[model samples]
Target: MANDFEVGVDVGVDPDAAWRLAGDPVAIRDWFGPVSDIAVDGDLRTVTMGNGAQLLERLVDRDDAARTYSYVVESGIPGLTSHRATIRVVEAPGGSRVLWRQTATSDVEGYDIEARLSGVMTAGLESLRDRLEGAAA
Candidate 1:
């Protein structure tokens, strides 16, 4: 079965700033708390999570004009056959909104992959909002 999820958060920043922060690979650790280390080469990123898990991600597409980025997971995470995700930033009434979408296929038994991923995305987005808005304040 395939699991998909989309999560978003609004921050007190413009679309450009939000996009710039979110799109930077090195800046990921500042918001995504789980990422302990990030090594970027060209369009590929190797992320080491806090729990010692490592993941290889390939950048699939990036549209600066649209403030969107997409990537696919090449490895890591048990039972996951495939994973693709995208993050997009758009203008909102007070500031900007970032939306993260994930689609995955997992064959692991006794694990709620969707819920876990959803929680991670939610926390990450909220952390991003706090970091950007707090710095401005």
Candidate 2:
């Protein structure tokens, strides 16, 4: 089965600031869940989670004009056949909104992969909002 979802977070920063922060994997490590270390080589990124889990991601598309970035997971997470994620920063009334979308296919027969992914996305977005807003304050 395939699962997809989007999590949006509004932060107290302009769209450009939000895009700048969201587009950098280094800044993502500061706010996105348990990411401990991030290393990038060209278009490939390796991320080490706080729990010592590691994942490889390939940058698929990035557009400054649209303020969007997309990537596909190459390996590391178990029980998933494939995973694709995208991040978009858009202007809002007061500040900006960061939208994270994830789509995945589970390798297992009956796993609640959607819920698991949703939890991670929610936590990451909340942390991102806090990080950006706190810095702006």
Candidate achieving the largest lDDT = 1
What lDDT does each candidate get? 0.88, 0.86
TM-score of each: 0.92, 0.92
Model 1 TM-score, all chains together: 0.92
Model 1 Cα shift for residue 82 (angstroms)? 0.9
Weakest 10 consecutive residues, lDDT, candidate 2?
110-119
Model 2 residue 22 CA deviation in Å = 0.8
Stretches off by above 4 angstroms in model 2 are: none
Model 2, 1-137: lDDT tens per residue? 33787889888899998888898756788888778999999999999989999999998889989999899999998878988999999999889999999888876887665677778878888888888888889
Write candidate 1's Cα lDDT for 1-137 as tens digits. Answer: 32787899999999998998987767888899899999999989999999999999998888899998898999987788889999999999899999999888777775555678788879999999998998789
lDDT against true structure, model 2: 0.86
> In angstroms, what RMSD does candidate 2 have relative to the true structure?
1.5
Provide the lDDT at 80 for model 2. Answer: 81
Clashes of each: 0, 0
